[model samples]
Target: MPIYTVNDQSIHVWEEGASDKQVALLIHGWSSSWFAMSPLFPILSRYRCLAVDLPGYGQSPKGDDPVSIVAYTDLLADLLRQVTDQPAVLIGHSMGGMISLTMSLRHPELIERMVLICPTISGRLSMFINMFLGPLVVLERVPFADRVTSLIETRIWRITDRVMKPASYAERSAISSEAHERIKADVRRPGQGQIRAECYRAMRENDLRGQLQKISHPSLYLWGMEDNTVPLRDASSVVAELPDADLRIIPNAGHWPHFEALVTTQRYVRAFLSTPIKLLKAQF
Candidate 1:
């Protein structure tokens, strides 16, 4: 319920646990708010955990135009400066990962470490396809573009509903029924649609493959083998590019592995964070 006014935007933020020694910032993916990373709450709370609804999503107020991922990086940096004095570990999922990567490149001092979950780096061929066919895909934002994409997303969600059923059992088991309901309720916020549209637009225009080399922070890249959204094949390419990076794949998990494999994901994350880099390097 806490809100911080940053750069004329009202960002809804929440914190769990009270710790001056460590802090972790949770950044959600496209179409998701702070709740998307709720699966990590229990484990992350052991440290100082800060989850924020990016501008135009959840309780955060909407902006005039959908801002670019770089813009988000700037916003997050400013927010960090304003809120906590502690350097924070940035945990970003999907688009949030993109923001985190940008942050590392632009504001490495703000982060102690990074955890990227199914992060998007390159502007894949799919994005090109969307670029050429996008105008025809949607009709709202741009003539014939928004409508087309809206229709495509609607159908994609329909298919996702079917394909996602297998993982539902795990997702349901990971969180209580009540918590699941809360997640669904949060997704239904009025700003969600606009936020989704703006995000899609920003993604279409932003490509950061050229900038990955600039990031020097130690990073953990987590992937879900079953993720149809961002294929697992991209993981190796990302790892190869990052200077200090490690990879982990979650089995029987989709894009939302934190939800489907919450316990396993949290365990690995904590273990990774606790392990001394020198010791880990010695073992290798």
Candidate 2:
């Protein structure tokens, strides 16, 4: 783990692979840290893989910065400008995917391509989460809410983790126990109540469906067939909006397809990255 100073904030990054190879910046979703993306490291070893623990999560302190897609995109743009001269590949999941899409639209010169996994493209999420979990986030505005939220947040996430896993035991076993623990650890981190509430609110309020068509970068979109967090129909709608993008829904996989179907996910990523950008664009 290496900590880099970006916009005067200490951003923790998990760097892997050879420096001489092409750069691949991996961004994890809400409530997750760089460790959540560890499963894809082996497949992306051909590139200089850099996974970031965004400001609010993991080792990075949220501080006073407002957590929004634009704020995150600015932080990453500045970080990349300081670190790499050439454009890098963006691999983003969920909220991170929205950030990547925004980056491509805002700073197209800094991005070569993108890989979005089960991205949240609209304000609409699963009815269950929106109905149940969304209210808890709103309670953060009330007195002593942080204290109250801290106690139940862990329980809620643990149940969510189990529910998000694949149905089959073999598919569930594909994701290491340690990986699941890592995600839980992020929830247990101090001051996460405010961050979680803010992030959830931000994600729910932000919608990028109309803006995605402006993104010209050749992109790959992966969705879990059984995803309940972001609907499969929404995923298809998002892919259809993009100018140069393709969608692959992994069967028997849920929201975390990269972990549940590692081999299949890797194969798709490898093939996508190996193809010429021109060829990919021509397909659309």
Candidate 3:
């Protein structure tokens, strides 16, 4: 693990696999750190994988600027330049996916290709989703809300652990106990409430739908069939806007497809990243 500075921000970075291999930069979603992308690390042995804890999440401390998509894209752009000389493959999840899309539009040279997992496009969505996220955003403004939320979620997960356990070992590994604890700790971190609230607001205000047609890189969009957070229906329409992209739906999975269906996720990601560009585009 190493720390890289972007202006006043200090980004915590973890790298795995061989240096000689093609670079694969993993970007975690909102309220998540590097661990959110860790499950895919094992399958990326052929690549020089790099994951970062964005400011205001994980080990990285919040910078002076409020957490926003544009700020993140700028940080990542500078980070990629510092970490590698070549354009690396961008693997972004959720908010990270939004950042990747923005980067692809703004700094295409920094990204050789893209793999967006349940990415956010327009801030709009179904009423059901609004009901789900609205309260969380409001709760962030309350004092000690994080502790209460964590306690409740911890209990809920504990109660359902056995019933919710995946049948396969590979899927189980994706959401191991260690990963759960780390994610819980991230939720309870100081200033996290403000960060979360700010990010939610920023995402709601920012829209990238109009810009999708400008993205030139080959892109792979992975969406969970049952994702309530950013439903496939809300994002699937944008696939047509992308000049070169493919959408793969993961069955029986939620927002976290990598956790719910590790093997399937790996299959699509590996094939997309390894296949020849011309051949991949031909299939679409």
lDDT of 1 by residue, 116-157 (tens): 888877634233335543343233346355445455665544
Global Cα RMSD, each model = 4.6, 2.7, 4.4
Worst 10 residues of 1 by lDDT: 163-172
Question: Model 3, stretches more than 4 Å misplaced?
Answer: 139-182, 281-284
Residue 89 lDDT, candidate 1, scale 0-100 = 86
State the lDDT at 226 in candidate 2: 75
Judge candidate 3 against the unseen true structure and give its global Cα lDDT, from 0 to 1: 0.76
Q: Write the per-residue lDDT of candidate 2 for residues 131-161, one digit (tens) a residue.
A: 7666866776454988776678667666656
Model 3, TM vs. native:
0.83
Which candidate wins on lDDT? 2
> Which residue pairs in candidate 2 collide?
none
Candidate No. with top TM-score: 2
The superposed Cα distance between candidate 2 and the true structure at residue 280, in angstroms, equals 2.4
Query: Whose TM-score is higher: candidate 1's or candidate 2's?
Result: 2
